[model samples]
Target: MNTTHRTIVSRRARPAKEPLSQEVIVKQAFLLLREEGISGLTMRKVAKTLDTGASSLYVYVKDLQELSSYVLDYALASVKLPDSDSEEWKNNLFAALISYQQVLYKDPGVAELALTTMPLGPHSLALSEYLLKQLAASGMQAASAAWGLDLLLMHVTSSAFEHVSWAKNEKRSFTLMKEAYLSADASQFPFIHSHKNELFSGDASNNERFLWGMEVILQGILKQDQ
Candidate 1:
């Protein structure tokens, strides 16, 4: 007769699980967002990742929405900001926003969160404060600064989303659209036919186009203040 023997590991010998806390829960959720994207981030998944019951997560987070806000804010912690007293305030502002865009560009889930969730956390507040201060230094009125901040953030978020979407195998759709635009009937769409090359001039991989758009928006805001 053949017999099988196995060693049983004692629970006491196992490593202790990390203590549950709001920060831990949020970090786990952020991990899920990076690994499995926005769709995979949930209380149940975060609880599973932490080796705990989903109900336990409720003690730390109110709901998925609240947790998403926390996760978004957590991800924003990596964004680099320039010195407050930098002489090149405009360039500094642009650099800060570009840093923010690069952060979102790294993960499609983050871009989605930036567009859909308004994170009311310290990191989010810091980014907003930094941008507002930069805008103020440029002689922007309070109203313009506030509204321009929204527009600037929206542009970066949307641009990141579009770039990520294209990178994630959506290029076929873009290609087909470009072909359709380029092949438009000259008699029907004269302008599109004439400017087809310029229409698709800059691809998403180029930062020059993004910077140009930023310049246009900044110029508009500055002019509005005048």
Candidate 2:
């Protein structure tokens, strides 16, 4: 009967668990990159997003440069090269480049990060190796294939940065540019004004511009093969 007089107490609340490893932290950083862009990415911000102390991140990532490399590698790791057996190596290369561009454009911040950092991780190396192998298979010399891969990747990253920049600061009116061109003295700038339609085509889509560059590079490679 005396046991009825006592009441049980509730257990104390448990503290939140820390991330299992740097892998989870890096994953969260990428999530932040996707949502907020590069400008919004910072150690403090990523820590907050991941619900951890910023100092803890330093143990896994030395600095923004390292973190940036990790993020770029993580993003690019998902891009699978096209089939190597197709014999249309040029087309496959072009398609792989397109896939790469799509991934970069999807996360504009990663595209910007890519411009500053060279590929140093396993994922980046794998991508370069795949492309180089594809190019060599397509009749390109090793040196030529290496250089071409470099040039193509540079163009893609830079182009993506340019597009992101333009999108962020697109206040300049295409209409105003056209009007000024139309009102200019034809004899003074005839060619410039004559191509106004083509010039002021209101921004090219990343896919279209990427495909165009791919075609140009592929053609050049074909010429070299001859």
Candidate 3:
């Protein structure tokens, strides 16, 4: 009468993990950048987010800087380039560059990376090629198009990078800057005194400033074409 009883155990199958590669690592790094921003994208942090060891990340990237750089390149892949006609090419190019700036602004660390790093990754190269093509079609000569890439990127990245830095600094004190302007011996600085409201008008209106700059550059480009 020693009838036996059996116990059944149930288990849920786990999902297969994505295979690890440089691309995979960079993808995770991008998520970290979006979540915690540039400073939060340390190697250890990214590793933890990816559920892997910090050492494992080295298999893909050389170091934390390289990892951040990789994240920039990875993010760049999302930028879609259109192949519209050269007609209205100046405006088309302006719109494209604006898209590029918006992409960097959305991802804080990227503008600095784009500015400092050479065009290496696939997306960066594609962007460069697209800009060059558009510039040529927009009536830029060989030299103008060649330097135009540098000019456009330099201006956009510098502006975007400064804004990113300003954004991240919780202790950012514009008080002194504003004070200086206000105190600028109004006798000599008639314009600053008169336009104080316009000058100190805060961050919410940056789009106008950005547009003004792009418009000036576009005007210069148009004159070159002429």
Candidate 4:
């Protein structure tokens, strides 16, 4: 009888796994989010990715909601904020908001988290501070600045979510919807039938439309101050 020979490798020779911490766990969660959107961001999957049990993750993150807030704030670190003393505060603010939208667009999971979780993480705080400072520079009162910040962030986050949802949907679905809009009865839906081209002029993912909306919101806020 012939027997196959096997060589056993020692585990000691293998590289050591990276030490687990809140930072490591959050990073792994973000990676999973990027790969599989919001559905992939689960404590079980994060622990699995880290080669640990779900119970071990609870030692660092209290629950999935906390993990989501951490991941969302971590992703917001990529947003580009302008220098404090920039002359074009309005332009810089718009640019910052645009950057914020782009950051959410990077990962749909983060966009979903932005809508659901109130992230108090360092990066999230930084974003809030930057927006408030810029709004103040624009002559907005404390109330307007606070409320406007909420509106601005909401618009950007919702826009990202809508764009991501559309991307996830079938193109045929959008085509059918567009066809329905185009085929609306002129007598019953005069505005929709007449302004069909104008209604469908721009894409949700387009920065021009996004910028226009930002401008409108800022103008409205400044107007309220006046």
Error of 2 at 155 (Å): 2.0
Task: Please give, for residues 101-151, the per-residue lDDT of candidate 1 as tens digits.
Answer: 999999889998998998969999999999999998887799999999999
Best by lDDT: 1
Residue lDDT tens for model 3, 106-191:
87767666766553478877788888888888666888888777888777888888777778773336667778887887789999
Lowest lDDT sum, 10 consecutive residues, model 4, at: 199-208
- Model 1 ranges with Cα > 4 A deviation: 1-6, 203-206
Q: Model 2, which residues run further than 4 Å from truth?
A: 1-12, 168-185, 200-206, 221-226
lDDT of 2 by residue, 1-226 (tens): 4666766655545465665476887788788888888876788998887777889899988887788788888888877788776488777777777777777777888888889876447788878877887788877677678778877888778877877766666537644656887677778989976886666553365466567776787668667756
Q: List the residue pairs that clash in candidate 1.
A: none
> Candidate 3: misplaced stretches above 4 Å?
1-16, 115-119, 168-172, 188-206, 221-226
| Estimated TM-score for each candidate | 0.94, 0.80, 0.77, 0.93
lDDT of 2 at 164: 74
Q: In order, how many clashes per candidate?
A: 0, 0, 0, 0
What alpha-carbon RMSD in Å does predicted model 3 have with respect to the real structure? 4.6
lDDT of 1: 0.91
* RMSD, one per candidate, in order: 1.8, 4.8, 4.6, 1.9
Residue 214 lDDT in candidate 4: 86
CA shift of 166, model 1, Å = 0.7
Number of clashing pairs, model 4?
Answer: 0
